[model samples]
Target: MTAFGISAFGAYVPRLRLDRAIIADAHRWAMPGLRSAAKGSRAFANWDEDAITMAVEAARDALADRDLSKVAALRLASTSLPFADLQNAAIVARAIDAPHQIASSDVAGSQRAGTSALLQALKGTQAELVIGSDHPSAKPASVQELTF
Candidate 1:
């Protein structure tokens, strides 16, 4: 018999949202439609916030009742990592105080990075803490950016 379980899950949405009208006004674009008009309230990470910070906050919340010593691995997924060479997941693991021996990895470059990490976790390979987040950028007045 085998049992695979979700040890924890957490999310952190930013407090501030940039309205769609602001984007439209900034780009001098005419209002598109009701859906497009409402698309503007996209969340924004604070000046002090970054992928690592958001991951740490979510990890803290997810692992609040669990012992990090038991977290055999940590996986972070983000498209807005602060550095290209540095491993962002390692930073998050350290921030959350995971055991020194635990494995850590990062998945980046796309919005689906988090989903990919989750797939790995479900395989019961090594990851125990998988964190996925994105602060994806879009051109002002672009519909894609507005929705995200």
Candidate 2:
């Protein structure tokens, strides 16, 4: 059997970071438990950045000094996609200037989206670009907001 493995890998982190302590302090009155978990900070995407943009960045990084024509497929995993009606992966593909015929898909809905896409990519025969990017937006004072 032919071997299929990752040849290159890359990641992108938003330049802006919001300290957890600030988040905790903002909602300390409602959730006192947040104070203890406020040691580090979390990456904050800029107003112009979204899951698609971040994925494109990471994909470009991974493709650096590499041939984009080799990519046969693209799988973007995210719980917070920008569009519901449009194909989000296609946007990433376009941003990265991938081949027009490349297969593109968006994996979402649950937390397992990223892992599932990775597994699929590993099992596929073609050269696949699997990207996991999420811009989590949660309600104020919620655990998700505090953690994400």
Candidate 3:
């Protein structure tokens, strides 16, 4: 199904980028190991940029200048979904103005979630919108601070 490929793409990154050296400098004293991963900058989500919101931004980009009527599903893959009880894919589908009948699901927990969702969708006939978004957070001065 080579013809069954992506026709459009969209993306969004936060305007705020955190230099990795800032993390290395601030925490190297306690966690010197961080220096190894502190060369590039990382996109730091703003207070308003949650996984759902970012996914919607991407959906907006992907759906722009295209016909979404053929889309049968919205698959959201993430390590950190915003709501524990709510379906994030549904939230994104709604944000994109997808038909209420559109299928929605979450591929989460594992690093291969996106691949898994794509493999599954490839078995179907209709186009599927797969989105990957993350907003990992940590407490101040913690290992996660440097890691994230």
The per-prediction CA RMSD against the true structure, in angstroms, equals 2.5, 1.6, 2.5
Please give the CA lDDT of all the candidate structures. 0.78, 0.91, 0.84
For model 1, the run of ten residues with the poorest summed lDDT: 31-40
Question: What TM-score would each prediction reach against the true structure?
Answer: 0.84, 0.91, 0.85
Per lDDT, the best of the predicted structures is 2
lDDT of 1 by residue, 1-148 (tens): 4457675688888888888767766665454543446543778888888878888998888888787776788889988888798988888888888889988899887778988988888888444899986766666556765676
In model 2, state the lDDT of residue 136.
Answer: 89
Let me know the TM-score candidate 3 reaches against the reference structure.
0.85
Candidate structures ordered by lDDT, highest first: 2, 3, 1
Q: For model 2, how does the per-residue alpha-carbon lDDT over 1-148 read when each residue is reduced to its tens digit?
A: 7657888999999999888899889998889898888888888889999999999899989999888897899999999999999999999999999999999999999999999999999988889999999998988877676577
Query: Which residue pairs collide in model 3, if any?
Result: none
Per-residue lDDT over 7-78 for candidate 3, one digit per residue giving the tens place of the 0 to 100 score: 677897877889888987888778787787787787788888898998999889878877778888999988
What's the lDDT of the predicted structure labeled candidate 1? 0.78
- State how far residue 124 of model 2 sits from its true place (Å): 1.8
